[model samples]
Target chain A: MSVAGLYNYWIVILLMMTGFYVVISSGNLVKKIIGLNLFQASVFILYISMGKVADGGAPILREGITHYSNPLPHVLILTAIVVGVATTALGLALVVRIREAYGSVEEDDIHRQDESL
Target chain B: MIGTQLPALQVVVPLLAAPLCLALHRPFATWALTLTASALSMLVSILLLGQVLAQGVIDYAFGGWAAPFGIAYRVDLANAYVLLIVTTISTVVTIFARRSVASEVEAHNQGLFYTAWLLCLTGLLGITITGDAFNLFVFLEISSLSSYVLIAMGTERKALTAAYQYLIMGTIGATFILIGIGLLYMLTGTLNMLDMAHRLITVADSRTARTGFAFLTVGLGLKIALFPLHLWLPNAYAHAPSAVSAFLAATATKVAVYVLLRFVFSVFGVDFALGTMPLALGLAVLGTIAVLSASTVAIFQHNLKRMLAYSSVAQVGYLALGVSLATPAGLTATLLHLFNHALMKGTLFLALGCIAWRLGSVRLGDLKGLGYRMPWTMGVFVLGGLSLIGLPLTAGFISKWYLVLAALERGWWPVILVIIAGSLLAVIYIWRVIETAYLSKTNKTAGAGEAPLSMLLPAWLLAIANLYFGMHTGLSAGIATQAAAALFGIQP
Candidate 1:
């Protein structure tokens, strides 16, 4: 119930909203991809945050630290990060093709061209 | 070890085959690999379904770690059923793809097309079979990324734009889903769905759990293309290579709906989802809108593929409406439709692919008087159309019958009226194509011919399946009832 315990989650939410807002409001295709990257990165932070143990060390298999960070979330987030990167690459490639085809990366311009067609 | 290995093989077989398909670098060899991989996956899924059916639920812990601590693959009736749908569609589509891809895609890229097709198959099956929420997100991306490539492989220039639009929208949806999974993990500290479900029940009244639910619903709703979220669907389906459209329209959104169902019924618990929240009303309202709006829109489309795509949205509404009913009967209807619609739509799209292959376009005008030239193909189209319109003796009618009964059981007469109205709209659009193909005068300038036997076989196989299942309700309805009962936490 303490304010201190909820700080990490609040930051995660803030980051998520910022990315979502950019994706929704931006007209530029590159900016949308960046927003998507930020959005996925924020989720990565959330997953990592959940893995934290009180006074825990990194999730290494060494002998010293008694409290190990949750390895499951770390593993899950690794897969997610891979997916995020793949999506980003695909999005950027699509943007490049769009630029070539439509001569603009702006959403409105693309739509206008499509309408004219 | 073999028991432990089954889950990994279910996904890995298809995954490995995809790259091998590319390595083969010949259309014939690639097709063989793709078909073998899909067929093997289908066999595995059937076996897994039988195992799960007998043993209640089988949870395979990954890397030798237990639940709440490790990733797991949980196979229950629900996922097993979805796995069956994904693999079955992949198998049929692969057979259908042989001739269709030969005609639609470049000969050199046929290998690449098969590679992507196998990868897409792997992703869909993985999404259905995986128990870990994050793994679901990963598989979702895999399927989605390949789908964009597959859609872009169409011969039309418009296919690139359609793929681009779908890429943008699909990424947004995946991001939302990832965020939802992140929120759930933050709140419950678990990635395993069963573990998360147990934890969620403890924190059911918390704001975090409620927020997570909202994110998950919206994210999955986007994937399912629920009404307003369906803007990207029509273009993608219309422009994608005909085989890709058939496979995707039949399988992709259905799997998304399965994910939504899993999260709602299994992870969130029925009490919180159905009793405490307005989810039922929301689903019912949006579903009704999708049915009426999309069907109405479908009637106006000149392109047969685009028309069926819109109709797919309308059919999706019926599935959602079934879920909203929140009864065993209702869920049964939803599951039945999920299977039946896949058969019907898969057939419809395959028929369109045949038309596209022979006529070079599926425009209603282009189809004029072609029924005589391609009797078998047109016959398949008409049969699929009959199913789409929910006529009495087709697979579509069985689901609609059950859905209507479910609505009546809930005293939702208005929903019954909506279903009937939607079916009527379906008839109009289907009749448009029928009239164009049969009644209109033929043009001497347009040379029409029948599709190759490879295409006709898969199309007719599904068309006949439409009739076969319609008559013999025991298999589809029986399994669906058991699956739905299991979903509702009821024992058969």
Candidate 2:
């Protein structure tokens, strides 16, 4: 494939690595979740990009449309999006509880407190 | 009529019951519902196994839509065997949970606790049964999400962080899986496992397929708590409510192993996974390292739960060892250990739950003379520990026997030595607890007699099953032999 044709995949690689790096590098609990979200969003983009045909219309039969993008991936990813939202919500809720329990959301602070306990 | 619907009802019964648990809002009512749902699925799994044995594989499409398009729940001997193990553990755990949950969890959260338990059961059972690759991912999340809720309900303030840690790791693992599936879908344009397998043959050497395989392995390795990726487990297990720890320890990672077996053999084919790849060698080497390192780590831990959690990782190494051999006899060892490990660990963890019930802690230092005071609980603890150490005539010995024989058949003497060393390490850790409880002196648990007969009954039931199934290997080993042979397309 040409460079232009591979543009979307390059974006996917960049986004995935960026998100992954932040997840491992950040000490703040909320930032990790955000990093996770960004990581997932890259895959969502990958799926959406792969499903697209260069000149295809939406996957609905029309009078003159000859090409159509795949709809299955979009539908599959919708379920994933819901799952992703649920994960973020639960993650944030846990963060709230962690803050209430430990008085801090930084990973190091929580560990230090636990050590003293 | 219901016989044909067994596959659907296997998951639907618990999935539907989960919501009612939240609506009921009373602890007793929800516990009853949880028990009922677990028991019903246990029955369905048994019937499914019987049907699979008598007939052939039972493939049921959801809503009457056929496969390669609509989702399918395919039950062969392997899937049925895993279902049987999972549902049975969930049922026993539910029985043990009544009193455990009452004392450990807050009364207000008890209903939601059972709700999450039922949903977790749904997710586990669904993962075992689904033939659609994407549907398996959905069920994986269902279980993962509920387990996070279940773990967070731990009384310790640290439970929050454990759950948080597991959430981050588990989600990354799941997303890796999703990406792997997405890559495979791009190549095959099919989500049905069997169809993907059939098409994967043509593109088995493609770089994309290999990358997909890597993602799947790493993601699953994390879920299975393979040695290096096992960071979340000890804290998660150690901090979880005893019942939650017991339940997850018995079912979750075992189900993950089942998925790995399914994908490697059924979907990827032995040729693709082992022939082209150095998977067998890699697994064998890593399994060796895991067994030695995790067992050594387990030996030094003071907390019983944390020790056992690390031991669980080592036990997973044994399973990986068995799978690495990649022969029919070898897989029999894997499957047999998979079932027997559940029985033994379920007994051990449940017994620990009882001890924790009285003393409110699982520190090895806490209970010195409790073996005399709580004879039955401690007696069973010894029994489960014996099995954990692979004592002769115990269930662990049976599987380890087969694992060694499988290795000997390959003339892999070093692997056999590692297996023995792993068992010896188990003895040291287990003996440490036994010596502390029986050999040391303390009146700490003076008034704490035995746990209620209600809870002891279930723990004893699992412990006794160790002896029963250990002596009689027809049910566990028989099905495993057939499944393993079937995987290699060999005559049994």
Candidate 3:
């Protein structure tokens, strides 16, 4: 947990916060979905980083391979990736529908239209 | 044969049915399939609950793998009770959805609605049954994704926006949960909930575990619509199709509460979750704020569904308050309310759906003289409202009474006062509905009539359940106490 060794987590945290901020602050629905994706990608990285064992080989058993990195997180992350993709697709489709409904995907415009209703 | 596979079938029946529903592409057939799956799930849940009651905790490990190495379905009193509540609500709502969906969704789209319905059902039951942390996340996403679709299927355009909003929020909540699980997995090298609980004890004092716990609480707080994080709930519930609203309001947040309870008591142990982290005080304060603020907000809402949506937030506060008290009695109150609130809210929302089906809207203005036109539907609404107000001989009173008793046991007089004040606010809001429906005058009511028996029957069924459970505490309270004991890690 030295300063140099901890930099990876720091970067992951930075990316996660940035993604969260964008999702919260952005007015456009598409940008929000991208922000969500970025946030999820950072989590994937964090999980993968935790699974890494120093000098460890891939989890597959092979001749002369004594140390193996954890494989479970990778499998879990694969499932998570599928979920994230599904969410993004759903979000994008909603954005398309929102455009059809409100004639815009921007939050401000949608709000104004809703108010006038 | 079915006894052994009940845990797996509880989820698989609905999971498999979703695609079958989609493939069938016939509205009537899909509805029939959804109804059958829901009924089957409900039956299995009841059987599982009976097994748990008779034989103690039932643990079914998948594919013959044991414990931490493979996923497990662990059913004790707590989860068995949750499973029953969720499947029962689904069964009832699906029965109620026949006319609701036909009226709200286009004929071509009804199959998709049933598909999403079964997926959501599958996801909810899976979350309740699974003992693995990662498996819970998978199920959470499954339910969430399908719900977003279901919400967007509303007749109103704003349903899209509400679905989008919930998508962002739900994904954030799920991601935070994933992070927490990842950190816990890193520390313990196990994704199994029980193993993590065992391992977490040793690392309880670690900064990493503390961070993970924080992530978990906030994530689940959002999912449970706890107080300040409840922004997505009102809109999502209000704008969704009436069947979706009734189903989600009744089961979704309740399941989230179950997860929070599992994490707090069973997984983290109450000592760590409540004692160490300032979580108890935070939850209590937030719950108080929600009860007061949301109820006050509810009183002002013109839309009946929106009003009930806000009231739901307030009811969640009562559950939070019980959890914050961190006593067996307090947890019992929370569990009892979990069941009672589902009955009350399900009935209320379904009645509103019936109103909407007849009148095309549930705005307070439109509801004028509804009591005269649709006496049965309005009568159901009145019963639900009474229960919501914690009237004597209604299920709501039992939960609030238990909460008050728990507060008294702890000598928390102010909390007792807060609970009473919250109920008063509920009375005010419920009165608004009654006043608009029964007292206000309206014109052009000749075409109006009772909601079809299809809708009214299911609505009255739950309405009567509200009264039945109100008088008969043997089932709800008895199971609640046993579940609470099990949650506290006692074998009783």
Give the DockQ (2 decimals) of all models. Answer: 0.59, 0.91, 0.97
The alpha-carbon deviation from the true structure for residue B18 of candidate 1, after best TM-score superposition, in angstroms, is 1.0
**Tens-digit lDDT track of model 2 for B1-492:** 889999999999999999999999899999999999999999999999999999989999999899989998899999899999999999998999999999999999999999999999999999999999999999999999999999999989989999999999999999999999999999999999999999999998999999999899889998999878999999999999999999999999999999999999999999889778777887898899999999999999988999999999999999999999888888999999999999999999999999999888899888798888889999889999999999988998999999999999988999999999999999999999999889998856446888988789999999999998889999999999999988777754
Of candidates 2 and 1, the better by DockQ: 2
- Cα lDDT tens digits, model 3, B251-285, are 99999999999989877889999999999999999
Query: What TM-score does each prediction get for chain A alone?
Result: 0.93, 0.96, 0.96
Model 3 residue pairs with clashes: none
Worst 10 residues of 3 chain A by lDDT: A1-10
Model 1 regions more than 4 Å off = A1-11, A61-65, B1-5
Judged by whole-model lDDT over C-alpha atoms, candidate 3 comes out at 0.94
**What is the CAPRI rating of model 2's predicted complex?**
high
Task: List CA RMSD, all candidates.
Answer: 2.0, 0.9, 0.8
| lDDT tens per residue, model 2, A36-114 | 9999999999899889988999999999999999999999999999999999999999999999999999999999999
DockQ of 1: 0.59
A22 Cα displacement, candidate 3 (Å): 0.8
The CAPRI quality class of candidate 3 comes to high
Query: For model 1, how does the per-residue alpha-carbon lDDT over B1-492 read when each residue is reduced to its tens digit?
Result: 565577878999999999999899899999999999999998988888888878888888878888766678888888888888889988998999988899889999999999989889888988998898888988998899999999988877678778877887888788778777878888887788988898888888888777788888888888898988998899999999999999999999999999999998999988899778789999999999999999999999988899999999999899999999999999999999999999999999999999988988999888888888899999999999999899998999999999999999999999999999999999999999899889998875446678989899999999999999999999789889998898888876
**Model 1's TM-score against the true structure:** 0.95
Chain A TM-score from candidate 1: 0.93
